[model samples]
Target: MQTIYIDADACPVKIEAERVATRLGVRMVLVSNGGIRPSDNPLVESVYVASGPDEADKYIAEACGPGDVVVTGDIPLAAKCVAAGAKVVKHNGEELHERNIGNVLATRDLMQDLRSADPFRQGGGRPFSKTDRSRFSEVLDRLVRQAKR
Candidate 1:
């Protein structure tokens, strides 16, 4: 059976992911420490892991497999899921695949190093917009349909 595993911490599209999962009849598990509210949807399950730094990440990675769809922005977790044969997608609708996971992981490491080296570097991404939400819905719809096959 296929499932959708969501790294719910700081994820902007949890509701959207639930909608797609519910519509597709796929089981969706939301893994987090304790911040996420439980979902009322039958197809959705909210999993609260221990309050360790990567407990949720470890749980999601261990549960995800060949027929799973993982939603997360954590590049390392995405890389691990991709290695485990699951299809991974970012909240902004970017699909992380085998073809590009390596480069993405490397760049993530590089960026982390740069950030740690510079104490004055303090910036974040643009606000998540309505257009991004729409795009994520479209990509998730397509991915769920493909996973169902």
Candidate 2:
């Protein structure tokens, strides 16, 4: 059966993903290092990993396989999930598959390099908007439906 694995640290669409998973009858796993409330819903499973960098990512990457869907903004985790044959979606609703994972990983590495080389060059991405939430919901719904079949 297909499952939805969410890298839940700082994830904005947790509720949305849960709703979709519940509606679609697919299991949704929210992996975090703690601080997230465990859901009462039977369809949702909240996994708390040890408090350390990438612990949740490691869990998701190792558990997910073909027909599974992963939701994360971490480019490296997304690349790993994609390589493991799972479908990956960014927080902003972008899909990262085998065809584009390399480019996305490269761009992320380039940005990290630029940031480290220039400490003063510090600026984060735009704030999450309602439109992004809507897009994510739609895309996630579509992906889950596809995974079910």
Candidate 3:
């Protein structure tokens, strides 16, 4: 049984994720640090971890294993999930597999280093768009179908 684990701390696609998981009949777990509302859907549940920076990430990683799907924007968490044989999808709907995890992690580290070096540096990432939601919906549907196989 493949489950969907979401890093809900800073994720912007919770509603979309819930809708997809419900439609796909996959159990969805939203892990957070107590900031998110509890879901009423029996298939969707929210797991609030202890208040810590990486507690939510740790819980998500520990709960997922092979054949599971994880949605997260955290590059390190995505890399860890991929290494654990779980499929990872970014909030932007990009899939991260073994082939590209290294490059993603490297780029994330490089950006972190740059930010640390220049305190004034800021991330240039744009706000999530409707296109992103559409892409995510399509990719998530595909992934759910694949997981059922």
The lDDT leader among the candidates is 2
Question: What lDDT does the true structure give each of the candidates?
Answer: 0.90, 0.92, 0.88
What ranges in model 2 sit over 4 Å off?
none
RMSD of each: 1.1, 0.8, 1.0
Q: Candidate 1, residues 1-149: lDDT per residue as tens digits?
A: 89999999899999899888878889999999998989888888889999989999999999998889999999999999999999999999989999999999999898888889997875767988999888888898887788777
Candidate 1 local distance difference test against the native: 0.90
Q: What's the true lDDT of residue 29 in model 2?
A: 96
Alpha carbon lDDT at 5, candidate 3:
93
Question: Measured by TM-score, how close is model 1 to the native structure?
Answer: 0.95
Off-target runs (Cα >4 Å) in candidate 3 are none
Candidate 1, residue 55: how far the Cα is off, in Å: 0.4
Candidate 3 weakest ten by summed lDDT = 140-149
Q: Which pairs in model 2 have colliding backbones?
A: none
